[model samples]
Target: MDPFKNWQDWRKNLDAFFGENFLSSFENILLYNYFPQVNVYKTDNELIVLANIPGLNDINNVDVFIDYQSLELRGNVNLKYKGFKLIQDELFNGHFERKINLPYPVKEDRIDATYQNGLLIIHLHRLIPDDHRRHKIEIKKIEE
Candidate 1:
């Protein structure tokens, strides 16, 4: 019983157990965990978010929710080829939900979203807090 032959047999058994495409399937699972990559940008008075989501048949089907300082996105990517078998699939397909925290609170009514060329762009205005309600306290020195 040669060590090299035994090692090769063990590896073959492991590969058979896991399947030949096990590694690719595992990578796809990990990659799709954060599907539709997003980028957030902050300006002086607004925030801009860009999301890469393709294969959207209808933009109206996607749901976008904005809270005071958080944004939620829910959508699905469908790419079906009729009468054709999938040889390789790198694109994400199915339902996905992602929540993002904003750097500052945003005004719910002042948001605008648009989808163009597979990119979802959102513009949100920053919510300004009222400064008039803030009160300053005076310090007094005391003698012991």
Candidate 2:
């Protein structure tokens, strides 16, 4: 029998076995990079993205980019400790990048972003079309 069916199940089992804080250490040892957590919400006329990235004190440390249908996030978080004996550390550091696909077309020029209290919030205005219904496609027989 397979111990885990998917990545989420494996991560959950690992978290149960080693605890949440210790999983970070394990992930750091096994993985090359880390990514911040993000949540995306969509409405009829807008899309909102919230990224949880701790230790981002400088605005220059993070970058956000978006087009009509996609979003890209790139940044670096520094966790360098000088002259101190390190114990347990759960926070993720170093460079990270994440890309997200938006559900609807948006106006790229009307996008706005703000970072506060370790959370990066982005608002994108959706482009309204004359028709919002899905168009049916007619399948033609391909001559092979």
Candidate 3:
């Protein structure tokens, strides 16, 4: 009885028990954390975000939120093909939420988001702090 032969037999048994898609399933599980993949771009005065989220019946189903330092997204991808057996399921179909940190602080009031062609585009302007808000304090020396 060779050790190499025993190892091969064990591998065969595992494959037979888990089926061919076991590897794919494992990959999906590992990659599930970053669903609806997004690309972020930063300019001198603006920050742009592009997200890929398809299979949405209504664009309103997605919610977008932003703050000075981050952007939050919550949505669902539903492909309405019910009453049929699914084979080779690969497309993402479920609820997903992702919070992305912005490169710079963005102005909350000046933000825009649009959805078109299965893509969500977000445009934001960088926040410039007001210089006039700073005030000088006077120091007094104590006399003994």
Candidate 4:
């Protein structure tokens, strides 16, 4: 409609395209942006989540937990700089958060987590139900 609107749309399109193209590079630049890497997988009895959190020193500062069906991870980054002059900055040096929804219920009490080499690994086991799911099937005839 207007110039501003046209520019906004064009910017959004450009961002989407460039973001996809540079995703790999962006992921590699965690020191600048604090992009937390995440890997999720599941088995019949367990679900695991691995997150890459670099430049974090204090374990108490990082808050990691799962509530209900969603896993909430959040933490504030600590800057490790000494008499540094402003030059170029693209990395997000601030608070970060990432949420992931679980497909099935996880055992909250049986969670195992460890943070090493800027990588946070979390392990969770599934809680199975006593009752089994029941399903019904229907048949249809072909018509000419």
The TM-score obtained by model 4 is 0.64
Residue pairs that clash (backbone atoms under 3 angstroms), model 4: 32-91, 32-92, 33-91, 33-92
Ranking by TM-score: 3, 1, 2, 4
Q: Rank the candidates by lDDT, best first.
A: 1, 3, 2, 4
Better of 1 and 2 by TM-score: 1
- What is the C-alpha lDDT profile of model 2 across 48-130, one tens digit per residue? 99988888878798999876788889999987779986687667878889877788888878989999999999999988766
Clashes in predicted model 1: 0
Global lDDT scores for all candidate models:
0.83, 0.79, 0.81, 0.72
Q: Which of candidates 3 and 4 is the stronger one according to lDDT?
A: 3
Residues 1-144 of candidate 4 have per-residue lDDT tens digits of 112325446556766988644444543463343256577888888888888777787877789878856788899777748888758655456788877777688877889989998888888988676677766788898999
lDDT head-to-head 1 vs 4, winner: 1
> Least lDDT summed over 10 consecutive residues: which range in candidate 1?
1-10
Best by TM-score, which number?
A: 3
Model 2 misplacement above 4 A: 1-34, 129-144
Candidate 3 structure quality by residue, lDDT tens digits, 47-125: 8899998887798789999877889999888875879888877778889998888888999899999988988999999
lDDT (C-alpha) at residue 66 in model 2: 79
- Deviation in angstroms for 82 in model 4? 2.5
Q: How many angstroms is residue 120 displaced in model 3 relative to the true structure, after the best TM-score fit?
A: 0.1
Candidate 3's error at 141, in angstroms?
A: 18
Clash pairs, model 1 backbone: none
- In TM-score terms, candidate 2 sits at 0.67
What TM-score would each prediction reach against the true structure?
0.71, 0.67, 0.72, 0.64
